[model samples]
Target: MARSDDAIAGSAERTRSVRLALASLSLSMLLPSLSTSIANVALPTLAQEFSASFQQVQWIVLAYLLAITTVIVSVGRLGDLIGRRRLLLAGLLLFTGASTLCGLAPTLWLLIGARAIQGLGAAIMMALTMAFVGETVPKEKTGSAMGLLGTMSAVGTALGPSLGGLFIAGPGWPAIFFVNLPVGLLTFVLAYRYLPADRKGAKTDRARFDNVGTLLLALTLAAYSLSMTLGRGSFGGLNVALLLAAVFGVGLFAFAEAKAASPLMQLAMFRNPALSAGFAMSTLVTTVVMATLVVGPFYLSGALALDAARVGLVMSVGPVVAALTGVPAGRMVDRFGAHGMTVAGLLAAAIGSAILPMVPAQLGIPGYVGPLALITAGYALFQAANNTSVMADIVPERRGLVSGMLNLSRNLGLITGASVMGAVFAFGSGASDITSAKPDAVVSGMQLTFAVAAALIVVALAIALVSRAVSRGVASTEPGAGA
Candidate 1:
């Protein structure tokens, strides 16, 4: 009877640990995801407060994005070599401290610098959250846990604009940054208390940090992101030089990784067709989704004559639907496998993107909401499935590095989508200023952008299909193949 009682207590303790881990992981995912979109709504206010031009104000967002893109892979590798839990806790502390700095910044440059630091923290947390989930949960429960993470991300993104508005209206723009304080502190405490200790094992002890490779990768990503962000708007000598530097940096990174004792990113990983295709599809899908999001407000306000409040409300339907469907989609991936779901989701997104141009501006909110929701729902399905498939195939030791690569693809897609779509919109509208453009010109620009987005998704779908076929072929050849 005493043994039986002890067994029961042990089971309860294990369950409690899992719950706490999930809570901490979810909050870790939420903070970065929320930060990505939250400052967007505050951009205009920030510009006014600092007396900055539109181009200058953009640095507020770009700085964060650039910082994350540059360091995510290196940090992820660091997590693998050292310990994910340690990295996560450290990241949380940095993020919280940076948020405090952002809130207190008296100058625009100071605010941008603080945001860059915050992004570094965000990159660390983002890189490891999935790896943490995979490590913490039972293998059978990974999909479900990832699903919950996806749901949190969707919810955070959807809530950012609304929350930003509330904070700005109530406690002022600085409150938007300040609000992260309590949440970050709470999350940090939970993680420190409940997260499992790193195992003292062979893998941890054997790996050496590759400093040279890390530097090359960082330089490559920074130059590439800068070229894309700046070159999209204009083709000046500086942009051209940056683009050349980015290309050179990529070549150098590849060469350095090949020679390094312990490469930051395994070049051989790209040989895994499923992994490569998954990363490509991730980038493409993000490009489609982000392009729509970047152009959405302009389309609504310029073409439909809606106010900012109404536009934000209308635009939120996509994320709400995505959040609602994320869990179920994840379960489906666990049951049916990622290939079919990814393909189906990409098709749905393609259809939705194709339909966007057809939505009459005269019909306004009702017409736009349905298609946007469809696209977001499709995105949720694809994301959950793709993430599961990608991580499932990676060796446990490399989960952190692969997670970083996955996020890197996403950030790249976002940057590319915004740059490419923005340029396309400008060309289509033939207007220097989107806000003051005529309705017809704005509508035309939006249509062209959606067409481009649809084309990108279609390409992603084709790649996904090919990957599925290859995956199936490999499985047939190796009956014992996992995932």
Candidate 2:
């Protein structure tokens, strides 16, 4: 009787510990996702305050994206080598410090610089968050655990524009960054108290840090990101040089990885059809989603003459829907597998994109909100399922590398989406002043942008379908596969 009672108490204690760990990780995850979208709402205000051009203002977001993309893989591997918990704590501290710097920056350049540092910290945290979840949760419940994380991410991302609008309207843009302080401190305390320490003599304890691969990868991403952004806005000798540099960097990185004792990313991982397809589809979906996000605020304010608060409110709808649906979508993935959900989700997004352009001019914000919500719902379904599929084939030991790769895909999508969509808007509208652009021109530009986004998602959908078929075919061919 005493032993039974003790067993019950121990089980209850473990359950409590698990809940605390999830809460701490979720809070930590929220910070980076929130930061990603918060600045989108504040971009116009920052541009006006600094008297900056569209190109210059874009660097505010691009700097952070670039930093994360460049360093994410290396940081993920580092976490594997050292410990995810230790890296997560260090990342939170760095992110918190950088947030403070961002709020205090006196000039545009300084703000951009501070944002880059914040991105570095975000890279570390983002890369390790999934691995930490994988470590803490039981294998059977991984889908549910990932679902909760996805829900928190959706909530944070969705709240960004609305929260930013509120802050910008009252205490101003700096308040957004300042708000992170309290949240960060609280999260730090919870994390320090709840997260487990690294095991003694872990596998990666003797593993070498791939410094050469790290430097090469960083250079590769830097060149590619800069080239894409620059080429979109301007076509000149500098752009040409950057593009060539990007190609050269990729070749060198590939060569280094092939020869290295410990590669930052194992090239052989791409041979797994599901993992490769998942990553590619993730990048494509995020590209369109982020492009729409970047364009939405400008469309509301510039074309429709909506106030910042209204714009924020309108943008919040999609994320809210996504947050609400993300967990259920994840559960569906666990039961039904990721393939069908992914295809359906992409179809929904494509439909939404197709309808966005046709939204009547007279209907105002209501017309946009419906389509946006549909798109976000699709994204929520797609991301949750796709994330599970990508990680399904990966071994536990390699979760850190795969997690980094996942985030790297996202940052790359963000970079491409922002730069490409911004350029399309600029060229199509032919308006130097975004805030004062004519409504007809802005509408036309928006239509073109969405059309392009729709086409890209279709391509992703086709890829996903083909991959699923191939997977099924392979499985059937294996001896006694079902048994």
Candidate 3:
């Protein structure tokens, strides 16, 4: 009876630690996404304060994103080599300190520089949070953890614009960043107290960090991200040149990785059909989601004749739905299994996108919102399922690397969607400039863009199907075979 009592007490203690670890992880997921959306809303105000052009002010946002995109994979690998717990605590500290710098900077350039540093910190947080799940949470509950992270991420993204607007209206732009201090400190403490210490004598402990490969991949990702980001609505000669450079960088990276003593990302991982398919589908789906972001505002304001407030309100539905659905979607992933949930999520998204262009203009906000909500819910479902599928069975040593790749894929998709999807909307609208386009042109562009989004989802579905088939074949061929 005494032993039984001790066992129950131990279980209760572990549960408490797990909760603390998850809280830290959730905050880690939230900060970067919140930072992204919140800063975007403050760009106009920042331009006024700094006396900078749209291009100059845009860098405040771009610097953070670019920093994250470039270093996420490297930091993930670093966490694997060194230790996720220590690195994550360092990240939280860096993020909090950088946020203070962002609030205190007097000049625009200083702010941009600070944002870049903040982005690096955010990169560590984003890369390692998911990686921590396997260590912190039980195997049966991985889906729940993934869902919780997804929910926090979506909440941060959804909450940002409104929160930033309030800060800007009251305490001013600095508070947008200053808000991170309390949250960051709490997250850091929880993590320090609850997270597992780095394991010693592990196989990865002896592996050297691949400096050369890291540099090559950083340059490659930087070039690609710039190509997709710079010039925004207009793809110019610089964009083309940057894109070409990125292509070359990819080749160089591949060569460097092949020759490295310890590659940052194993070249052999791509051979796994399911893993490859997960990356591809994640990229494709995020691109579609970005289409909604890039295109939805224009349609709401122009085609639906909504005011700025109304447009924002309507736009919030997507992320709000995503946040609300995250936990349930995760539960579904646990109940239905990641593979099936992934398929179901994709199908639902495809159907939602397919139905969107057909939504009557007369139905107004409801027409637009209903379909948008469905798409976002599907996205929430897919993210939880896909992440679980990838991370659930991964070896402990490789979790950080794999998590980083997942995040990298997502960031790449958003960047591509912002650029490519915007171009598609403009072209489909037959407008020289989207912001000033006529209502009918805006409507046409929206339809065409969503049509393209549906097509992309279909492609993702096809890949998922093929991955499933391949997995079955591989399993059937293993020792003892189908028997």
Candidate 4:
């Protein structure tokens, strides 16, 4: 009787421990995503305050993005080599400290520099939070953990504008950065108390860090990001040069990785159809999402004749849908399987995208919001399932690296969507300046962009189907399989 009672108590304790760990990871995820969207709301304010041009103020956002893109993969590898918990703790501290710096910086350039540091901390947190799931949660609960992280991320992104607006209204633009102090500190405390300590003499401890590959990859990513971002809606020779440099960097990085004894990336992992498909599809879907973000506001304001407040209100639906569906989608993944859920999610998103361009302008907000909700909900499911499928099978030692690549793909997708999709929207609108495009032009541009977005999702669906078929064929060919 005593033993039974003790067993129940132990089980309860472990359940509580897991919940606390997840809370820390959730907060970790929230802070970075919050940082990403929060500052965008403050950019105009910052520009006005500093007497800066749009291009100069844009660096406030760009610096953070570039820093995250360049260092996310490297930081993930570092976490694997040293320890996720230790590195994550350091990330929390850095993020908190940098947030303070951002709030206090007197000059625009100084703020940009602080944002870059904050982005580094955010990169570490983003890469490792997913990696830490396998270490902290039970094997069967991987989907739930992924879903929870996804929820926090969506909540953070969704909350950012409104929260930042409140802060800007109540206190000032700087308050947006200052808000992170309390959340970061709380997350750090929870993480220090609940996260598992790194094991002694792990295989990761003996592996060498790939310095050449890291430097090359960072430079390559930075070049690519700048090439995509720097032109302010118009491409120039500098963009072309940076793009060419990025291409060369990729080839050089690949060569360096092939020669290295301990490559930062296991180049061979790309051959794993599942991993490849996950990364590719994530990029595609996220790119499509960017179309909505980049183009939706224009459509709402121009085509539908909505005010800024109304446009913002309507835009919030996507993230709200994502937050609402994340946990449920995760539960579905646990029940149905990641592969099928992934396919289902993609199919739903494709359908939503197809429908988006067809909604009548007369139908207005409801018309747009309904399809947008479906797309966002599908994305929530796909993201949760896709992450679970990949992360669940990853080896303990490689989780950090794999997780980092996953994030890199998502980040790359966002950058691509913002740049490439934004251009597509502009081209389809047939306007030199999208801000002054006609209502009819905005409507037509939205249709064309979403049509293209749907096609991208269809391509992702094809990849998922092929990957699934390949998995089945390989499974059937194994010695024990009779089929």
lDDT of 3 by residue, 1-483 (tens): 999999999999999999998998999999999999999999999999999999999999999999999999999988888888888899999999999999999999999999999999999999999999999988888888999999999999999999999999999999999999999999999999999998884334535898888998899899999999888779999999999999999999999889888888889999888889999999999999999999999999989999999999989999899999999998888888999999999998999999999987888998998889889989999999999998877888888889999999999999999999999999999999888989889989999999999999999999999999998999899999957
Name the 10 consecutive residues with the lowest summed lDDT in model 4: 198-207
TM-score for predicted model 3 compared with the true structure: 0.98
Tell me how far the alpha carbon of residue 428 in candidate 2 is from the true structure, in angstroms, after superposition. 5.2
What are the per-residue Cα lDDT tens digits for candidate 4 across 74-143? 9999888888888999999999999999999999999999999999999999999999999898877888
Q: For model 1, where is the 10-residue window of minimal lDDT?
A: 198-207
Give all TM-scores, in the order shown.
Answer: 0.94, 0.89, 0.98, 0.98
Off by over 4 Å in 1: 202-207, 475-483
Across 60-111, the per-residue lDDT of candidate 1 in tens digits comes to 8889999999999888888887888888899999999999999999999999
lDDT tens digits, residues 1-483, model 2?
Answer: 999999999999988988888888888778888998898778999999899987798888889888888999889888888777888899999999999999999999999999999999989888888878766777666666777778888888988877888999999889989988899888888788887777564445435888898998898889888877774455578867877998999889889989989787789988777988988988999999887777898889878889976886787787789889888887877777777888888999999998998897678988898888889888888887788778776775677788898878877887778777777777777787666789888888888889888998999999998888888888988999978
**Clashes by residue pair, model 2:** none
Q: How high is the lDDT of residue 57 in model 1? A: 82
